[model samples]
Target: MFVPFLIMLREGLEAALIVSLIASYLKRTQRTQWFGAMWAGVFIAAGLCLALGIFINQTTGEFPQKQQELFEGIVAVIAVLILTYMVFWMRKVARNVKAELEDAVDQALQKGANSGWPLVLMVFLAVAREGLESVFFLLAAFTQDVGYAPPIGAMLGLATAVVLGALLYVGGVRLNLAKFFKWTSLFILFVAAGLAAGAIRAFHEAGLWNSFQAVAFDLSNVLSTQTVFGTLLEGILGYQEAPTVSEVAVYLIYLIPALLLFLMPARPAASATKDAREASSARR
Candidate 1:
């Protein structure tokens, strides 16, 4: 439940940010007439994502047990990849996202009256990117646990994000977006690592992976997954009571380096500019 909530919150916030930015830009340029087209794009993209998620989830349910496991494993892997890429991508672009978005809006509106369709397309693509990411992630998360908690949590998270986004756009809230993203990125890395481990476990269950099958350790005696604390850990961090060697290895291999890289301070813009100037001078 917590896992789904947090993931949805982060994902929703990202989509909200994109929408808010686009709307803000349109208003600032006194092109508020395009607001209708912008909203149409958002709704269309959202509908597409919803339909796709339902279709995939329903289709997978009809598969045989082994096939289901295989599907789960594949989804988990894809989710990990997408989550990692998004985390790093957001980090890289956080500083310039506003400017980039404004530029994109300018390009979209360059067609004058015909710009309506182009702006719609631009917003549609942007929102759909985030929506698709959320869909994949939610699918992966749902595969791990059964029941109503995950879905409920996701809905609540998304609702909260909408409220927050509205507040932000109205200048009613002032959030430290950089810190928020940075901390969430760390949490997401952990979640992705867990997904990586879960992927290995799922593959093994599907009979596709048999290497390094030896038991790494047995925590079932000390902390069974059936317990409250254990369940929380399993849901959030992909804790395993009796994980195999492959699962443990994959978890550490992904988590360790990911953490290191994420925590490493980014090169300052000033330093980068200085280096660029030096190179240009040498070339001259």
Candidate 2:
């Protein structure tokens, strides 16, 4: 439940922020007439995401047990890749996202042919990218746990994101986006590590991976995943009471390096700019 909630919250806010940035740019540029087309794109992209998610979820349920496990493993792997890419991509672009969006809007409107369509396409592509990422992630998360809690938590997270997005657009609230993303990025890495481990377990269950099948440790007696606190940990961090050796290896192999790289301080913009200027001077 907590896993889905946090994932959905982060994903939904990303999409919302993109939409708001585009909208804000359009309004500032006196392109309010294009608002209708922009909104059309958003709604269409959202509907497509919803429909696709439902279709995938419904169809996957009919597979045989082994095949189902294989499919889950495949989905989990894809979700982890997408989630990792998203975290780093946002980290790279968050500072310049507004400028990038404004430039995109300008290019869209400047196109001589079918200007409105370009803007619509731009908005659609941006939102759809985020939506698709969320869909794959939610599918992986839902497959791991059964019952209404995850779904309900996801919906609540999305609702909160929408309200927050609105507040931001209206200047009703202010947030330190840098800090927010930093904390959330750390949380997401933990989730992705768990998914990586879970994917290995799923592959083993599907009879695809057999090596290193030895149990890493047995904690079921002390901290069974079925218990309340254990369930919370399982949901949030992919805790397993008796994980296999391969699962433990995969978890640490992904998590440790990911954390080190993420925590390493990024090069300052001023330093980067100075280096670029030095290179240009040498070339001249």
Candidate 3:
């Protein structure tokens, strides 16, 4: 539950940031008359995302056990890839996101007078990217277990993001977005590692992997998934009582270099400071 909550919170906040930037830019430029189109784009993207999620869920619901496992494995792999790319992509663009959005709006408005399609297209593409990413993540999360907690956690996280976005927009709160994203990205790396390990397990269950089925070690006697804490860990970190040797290997192989690269300190601290200041100024 906590894992899904955090995932949704981060993704939702990213989308919120984009939308807030667009809205704020429009207001500052005295082009607020197109707010309706902005909202319409958002709603359309959201609706499409929801529909796609529902379709995928329903389509997979009727699969046989083996096919279900295969599907889960596929979704997990896709989630890991997407999450990894998102982490790196955001790290590269976090400093210039606001400026880029403002520029996009400027270009859109300049295309033609009384032309709102550009704005709509821009918002739709931006929001839809986040929405589609969230859908994949939520699907991967739901594949792990059967419970109501995941959905509840996702809803609460999204609500919190909306509230935080509103606070930021109204100047009621301030945040160091750089620090927030840095920590969350670290956490997400671990989560992705877990998903990768789980994907290997799912493939084994689907009978796609026959070798390396040897149990690395069994901890079922000490802490079974049936236990409360074990269940929570399993949900958040893909804890396995008797994980396969391959699973452990895959987890470490992906996590080690990824962590090192992600945590690598910037070469020039001065430039980082300048970028941070620029980001702050853009936010203002």
Q: TM-score for every candidate vs. truth?
A: 0.93, 0.93, 0.92
The better candidate by lDDT, 2 or 3, is 3
The sequence of per-residue lDDT tens digits that candidate 1 reaches over residues 190-252 is 999999999999999999999999999999989999999999999999999999999999999
Candidate 2 residues 59-147, lDDT tens each?
98999999999999999999999999998888877766766676667767778255688888888899999899999999999999889
Candidate 3 per-residue lDDT over residues 147-217, each given as its tens digit: 99999999999999999988888788999999999999999999999999999999999999878989999
Worst 10 residues of 1 by lDDT: 275-284
Ordering by lDDT: 1, 3, 2
Once model 3 is optimally superposed onto the true structure by TM-score, how far is the C-alpha of residue 150 displaced, in angstroms? 0.3
Pairs with steric clashes in candidate 2? none
Candidates 2 and 3 compared by TM-score, better number: 2
| Candidate 3 lDDT for residue 144 | 92
Error of 2 at 186 (Å): 0.2
Model 2 bad stretches (over 4 Å): 112-114, 268-284
